[model samples]
Target: MARPVPAGTARADDITAKARIRNAALELFARDGVEGTSLRAVAAAAGVTVGLIVHHYGTKEALREAVELAIVERFADAIASVPLDSRPAGRIAAARDEAVADMLAASPAIVDYLRRALLDGGGEQGDLVSRLSQLSAQQVHDLRAAGVASTNHTVGEQVLTIMVRQFGRLFLQPLVDRISHEFPEDIDPSRTPPRLTVELALDASRADDRD
Candidate 1:
């Protein structure tokens, strides 16, 4: 008969196993999409049994939620890191640039996840929408405190517009790729490059104030 494993050893194994599953799920889902991928496929990619995947995640929906939460947390952390104390307009511009760059670096998987969430219109999409709304409110508050313009549009409206633009850029990678070819480094988020979206948004906001 085999002897029982120590508690610490069992815990470590659990952690490693869960991490493996998550990493594999992320890769497969990124390449194959959420609906296209399967629990068995995820298990195969992770080099584990299907039962193990089920045991950890309980269901495909749970796994999807896990992935979405992880991605959102990374984005939130990235946005939070930007220094907001500078000139409002400049700071917002810088923050948006950095946020995009950070998201790009975090993983292309996030774009895939967003695409599914937007198209599916489920609990996951609702959760992400709510989180984004909160982020937008914070951004508006920061802008107002810094004395940036756009006093006419409510914070919710501005936030929703920005979120929509972000979703468009994220899901429509082909467009971004074509634009990148023309602008070269300017459109590439990896380089924290200048984004036309950011510039246009800021310009529009300022224009609103002017008019």
Candidate 2:
């Protein structure tokens, strides 16, 4: 059970309304996109006046930025919570998948938002991709340090591969489901079958040893 807020001031209500407006905009932007969505539409959906949104966020771009930052933070928080103390590659993969699933369950809109961001090509996509690649590269470095991954593989290429596997798998899920019969959304990332990450790591290790 959650604790109730203390006997309230208008501040709490104002915060709640602001959140509602954002949530409404999030849904609209996720579905219709930023270019397609309007302050009027968001206001209608949120059951608030357009002036209220303007008062809180000032501009649509600001509101969109806020939503994007919130989504990124949520993903970061989820991934950050995964236990990195384990050295086993499989365990690491499982933990990552668990975190992904948990975050998606809580905020399914994130998937739509990310997929659009990639496909539609706007809203800090380049920065987001760069951030994701950097994070993936660091994870690869950690796995290599743990002796569970191949040090021979360049972190750059590994990050690219991971990004494709992660986002491609997400954005093209319907087709993947049809052909591959794998639904990442339905199963935990860890519960799903082992993938190219382990194979690439093993290959790298083998190549290095042969040298």
TM-score of 1: 0.65
Q: Count the backbone clashes (under 3 Å) in each candidate.
A: 0, 1
**Clashing pairs in model 1, backbone N/Cα/C closer than 3 A:** none
- Residue pairs whose backbone atoms clash in candidate 2: 94-190
lDDT of 1 by residue, 88-165 (tens): 564564466457665654565566666666676565435766666676678677767767636676676667666765
Q: Which of the numbered candidates is closest to the native, going by highest lDDT?
A: 2
TM-score of each: 0.65, 0.65
Count of clashing pairs, candidate 2: 1
